[model samples]
Target chain A: MTPMTLADAANLHTFVDALRFIGDHPGFLAQKALEQLELSGAALGIAIAVALPLGVVLGHFHRGSGVAIGASIVGRALPSLVLIAAFLTLLGIGFVNNMVALAVLGSGPILTNSYDGVDRVDNEIAESARGMGMTGWQIVRRIELPLAIPLLFTGIRIAAVTIVATAPIAAIAGGGGLGDVIVNQASYRLSGVLGASLCVMALSALVFVALAGIQIGVTPRGLRGTTVVHDHSRKEQQ
Target chain B: MQSHWGDTLQPALVQHIELTAIAVVLGFAIAFPLALLAHRYRKLEHPIGVFSALLYTIPSLALFQLLIPFTGLTWTTVEVALVAYTLVILFPNIVAGLHSAPDEVLEAARGMGLTRMQTLTQVELPLAIPAIVGGLRVAVVSTVAIATIAAFLLPDGLGYPIVLALKEPTPFKTEIYSAGALAISFALLCDLALVALRRALAPWAARGLA
Candidate 1:
């Protein structure tokens, strides 16, 4: 084995120290994790409430594909740091302000995916449903929605992971989460920063995995392996 | 307004572009080979995709903080995270693009007496340009947006002005709006450039689509 350098030893010490910090501050970490979940969960709820209906309606009509895609492009480009700062003048600081900005941040994928999901359902299927005397809403409710669930849930998963990951930025905006420990490294030290980062990472992964399970569970049995989840519109979630 | 543009916005824009460009290029350099490797070896594809996706699921801020212990608060930490972000976006697109080259086309290239290297370099890669560029556009735009977070570590990029403005007793509205607008515009501009580049690179493909 190669001899370890002083830097390597220091790095090892830092890692162990961070682990110790996490072990010692379970309550603090849990509280921050809860804050993160609540903030992200609220934001995601808002995003789904606003974007899903609009997407579904537009997609049902096969109109406003431009609007859906455009939202995603703009959303992907909008920096959370800048967005929270810009909203500072209007919304002021705190959980509501950050929650609103994060909702806006999370809305894009939900809108785009929901639209793509409904719109991409087979024309034949829709027409056949129409032939069977199904109304527009009925077709949407019964056929289109069932078919669209897989992709729509994929959008929510993307948004959930993104919101969870981004929830930390709320700390910078005075909306406390795990980021409080992360940004206050002067007080918490490097160990705390690293520990908080680990917590945040774990929290995001938990959100992602949980949502993925929910997605799998909710997807129509017929659509499980058939839906093409990857496409150009679905890019980097982070 | 003029003074702010001269003293702050201009420098911030340059730094943002530089930071974004470096991260995307570095990401491509690392991801391209890995994508090619994964494409050639089918067994590696799932693992590589999962690994990159795992990196991407971590929020940008947390990723930067995670690197603080190892790399300190330098731009390297930011770059590493930014590059990692691009991998998840780039790898799948490149691998998909590679697989997109039809077997008929490969057979034709082989029939023309082209070596495996020649077939890949001359035939397959040219066809993959559109998909590769599509990935680049996403990576570049996302990187441009995420690179702003580098300001939390260093006083550079458009994020610097936003952070600075936030630090004020009353946030500087002009600074925040200007920086935010610049970052969005920069991302859009890069995206438009990539679209134009794709059209230029694969005119035949564009024509086919048209």
Candidate 2:
């Protein structure tokens, strides 16, 4: 139990001050975080809405899959900053512009993975579905989408991570979010910046973990059974 | 054509190309051998890969701040960050490419009396070239885009025009958008060049295209 040094006391004072600042500004931080959450959520929604349908359609019509692939490549190649600026020009900066930019970024992974997943589905199963007089939509809904779901989810997981990570850039362009807190507060209050950045990191990690959990949970047991059955049949054939 | 937007575009485009080319070439020059060394040493690979990954994960602005004490406000800071980013995308790729050479191919080359260097150059490197080139493409595009963000610290590149526009009144917003579009188009062109280069260098990988 030696006496505290001056350096130690100063360190303690800084730490206590940081804690007090956070305590006093809880609403500010929460509001910022909520804005980020809302923007991300909307972006994710729009991404899934557009990407899934486009992916499935392009995958089904495999004759011209290059179009979708080309689009995804363009999307991926375009910088998120550029996309944000483009949206800002058209929609003006705010929640809607941020949402559009993020959605465009998010679309690439989801669309590409979805196309790959559905394209890789067992062709024989699709032929069999057609042989049974099933419609194209039925074949997709029953056979293709189900089999492709896991890979589709993997794409979504990637998109989710990208959106969460890049969402902070929105703050720079006047879209309010955790990034605003980090960028603005960091100029004066280093502790606030650190706190906001930590929150962002935690949020990204949480989103990734949650998506992983959802993937594990939603994969149907019957699909595993079917995979096992296919393997068994292949072994017997050999 | 006589507007302020036009005034900003011409100089900004030149600066944009100059900065991007310098950063990309420098980053690749640094990344290639570092990747090779990391791949050669089993003990060094994981740690180096993880370190590069961690550096990449740190936000650009944070990395800038971290480097400020040593680099001050110079382009050196931005160059360091760009190079660090290239390593994250390039190292794993080179390692994977080297490892992708079939083990049997190496053994056969050795059995045929080829030395280690001979085996690497003749057998492993050719096989790895496609993947290495692919990684380079990714690295180049990523660095080009990220380099724009560096303009906040340094007064150069297409980002200068965009930042200037941001500071101006409402009527000048189009200048920002146009400059940004130009930047994106430049990235897109670089991406296309990489794809074409990859296909040209690795013709086998490009088979089935009419």
Candidate 3:
């Protein structure tokens, strides 16, 4: 079918009417979008729960970074749909499979970045921490973890955006989300698609802004100054 | 259902290979020039980056649906969307690789009476190859994996099995999961190959001494 055109305004209006009819029924656009938002949050929660500790442990071990990186690469290398399919096969369809696939996908960058952040902490600081007879956990908690917080937060932010944006794919496995609304609109030529897409975009933007605010709020002023100075020095060295 | 493994698996594998190869090649063709343009004009980088970021944010299914009106659910549509997706991964790598070349090295090349084209081709391009290839590796793996999603629109591939598995009456979901496992394994193998290739072509670069 040809794409509905501006000239087909009447048809578009009919489509809008159909969407309104669907909205009046149970489990429509607004409900589906809310369900998706919740699912996205759950998926992100799972990713952070799994990835943060793994990343910290891998960073501590040093040997495990390669393994973690490899895992992340694999996570990224797998298509979202394929992941959905794989999860669906094993777990059957619903929130669980969708959550697993999205969490897996979202975990990679977060894990990688967290590991990198911890690993890239100045060796001197770590050496001093050890020299002071600090326990391994103490060093990680006091020195490495605080220093890595900003970078780790960056990864989490990226993962949040990615999960929220891609959450619609869950609809394919019969997990309701904004994606379902988009698909429904396409199949039925309704106006709900536009509204649903707009909602998704709005949610994504809100998440991004909120994360940025959190990052700024959490960052230490001294570290921020050091980062700026470091950038300047690097530029001068170059 | 076809009982013969080769009848179902081989053709799908071959089709998967062909589709990924074509998409990677074409994606590089477009991404390289765009990267070059963005590198040349710093102002252009923002718009290009934003465009790719937006493209990256677009769900693959939604992107395919958007293209359907223009490309009619054909191989062309699938390939184009795959290429577009690849560009998002590759463009940043290419631009970063080029920019990573030391200013002194570039100045020396110019001092030696090299033209801009010659400097880019001989001096910059050679130096940037490893980084560009790193990006290409990412593109290749990503495109291969995402290519499976094209089965939703395309005629045949590993994704066909996935779709069929969803439709089948049998409880054996292994058929779909196995295909996904194979696809992921194939991606890992290709990634390893790229790593080996990078090591061979640029040992110093690989060793981080470059």
lDDT rank, highest first? 1, 3, 2
lDDT of 1 by residue, A41-110 (tens): 8999999999999999999998897899888888888988887887667899888898898899999999
lDDT of 1: 0.87
Candidate number that wins on lDDT, 2 or 3 = 3
Give me the displacement of residue B205 in model 1, in angstroms. Answer: 3.7
How does residue B198 of candidate 1 score in lDDT? 86
In candidate 2, position A184 carries an lDDT of 66
Isolated chain A TM-score, each model: 0.94, 0.83, 0.81
Predicted candidate 1, C-alpha RMSD:
3.9
lDDT of 2 by residue, A107-199 (tens): 988888788778767667888999999999999998888888787888898888778777877776777787786666436475666566656
Model 1 spans > 4 angstroms off:
A228-238, B206-210
Where does candidate 3 chain A have its weakest 10-residue lDDT segment? A227-236
lDDT: which is higher, 1 or 2? 1
lDDT of 2 by residue, B21-44 (tens): 776677667777876786677688
User: Highest lDDT: which candidate?
Assistant: 1
What is the C-alpha local distance difference test score of each model?
0.87, 0.73, 0.76
Say which candidate scores most in TM-score.
Answer: 1
What part of the reference interface contacts, as a 0 to 1 fraction, does candidate 3 reproduce? 0.36
